[model samples]
Target: DAGVTQSPTHLIKTRGQQVTLRCSPKSGHDTVSWYQQALGQGPQFIFQYYEEEERQRGNFPDRFSGHQFPNYSSELNVNALLLGDSALYLCASSPQRGWDNEQFFGPGTRLTVL
Candidate 1:
């Protein structure tokens, strides 16, 4: 069973640009969630997708959007990025229909905006 994987372990971008980060969920999982973790802060949930539909979402701007594919993988898209967007983007996976399920995180994709 493979664990979650994220692309471009690290990324650098300038303010006002757009970025897309990809994630592949763990085997046998159908739920994918995205989180943003600033330095010294706990992960903040962005949104969660199950069965290819968003089931839950957190308080984030419209700039933060995501998509889950049939393969159970997901992609997080951020538009008109700001310097504040610079943080660790984490992808978490859990079994479907289990809110109490423990989420497994990926190594994360570090984004640096200048």
Candidate 2:
């Protein structure tokens, strides 16, 4: 079965520009988490949303935002992009009813900021 999926496998942007990435959760999952992984670094949690409500967020600034749809799909939006913003954006999905459940990750969207 298909698992979590992300769109725009690759992206390129200039500093100060904005970008939006999309994701669809795995089957039977309603919780989606977004992560940012820099080169040679592990993924860092950005945020998680469930039931169309944002439930948790990490250290990222307000320039990063997300929205979860009723169908468990989600989108991550970044504004005022910087060169440091270049990274792979990941989307993971898990069942919200379970605590600390296993999250299935998408292939991620590689973003490069010039």
Candidate 3:
């Protein structure tokens, strides 16, 4: 019955550091995807997970990774962060992909890199 949730509404980090963002998907949902939204831009797909496995990945570098738990919760990890990495990290969830079921988005974790 709950919708997607993300931790740390705002975060500040320095270059070369690593940050981990968390997400709890909506109830009864089994798919979660991460996105990066820069200022004034729509989100760019980072990757997606289903059935506790990564099923699809975007054009992002290996520094970006994610994990999905059996419970449908997920985590987004960014390593060796750069100032350019600063953006809004959004987590979305749906019953599953391919079906294009309704997806709910989190409030997003805003990151600022120095």
Candidate 4:
């Protein structure tokens, strides 16, 4: 089965522009979560989507939003980006109906804002 995949492997943007990153979840999974990892920092949960609806959100700002499709794939959008937004944007997937499932992470789409 195909594992999680992310696009553009790397990205560079200005401080005020917007960027959209994509993710395809592993086969048979229904939950998608987005995380942000700054340089030398652990991944920080951004939000999670299940049943095509956002179920939980972390301590990120409104600029960070996401969407999940019926097929379980997902996209994360960051608007009005900042230099601080430069980090590895990781997408994780889990089977929603299962117990405290561990998330499988993508290699991540690194974003650098100048």
**Predicted structure with the largest TM-score when compared to the true one:** 2
Work out the TM-score per prediction. 0.96, 0.97, 0.95, 0.97
The residue-by-residue lDDT of candidate 2 on 2-59, one tens digit each, is 8999999999999999999999999999999999999999999999999899999999
**Model 3, stretches more than 4 Å misplaced?**
none
For model 3, what is the alpha-carbon lDDT of residue 13?
98
- Model 1 lDDT vs. the true structure? 0.94
The list of candidate 4 runs beyond 4 A from truth reads none
User: lDDT of each model, Cα atoms only?
Assistant: 0.94, 0.96, 0.92, 0.92
TM-score of 4: 0.97
Query: Candidate 4: worst 10 consecutive residues by lDDT?
Result: 94-103
Clashing pairs in 1: none
**lDDT tens digits by residue: candidate 4, 8-102:** 89999999999999999988888899999999999999999998899999999999988988788898999999999999999999997764878
In TM-score terms, candidate 2 sits at: 0.97
Question: Ten residues in a row with the worst lDDT in model 3?
Answer: 95-104
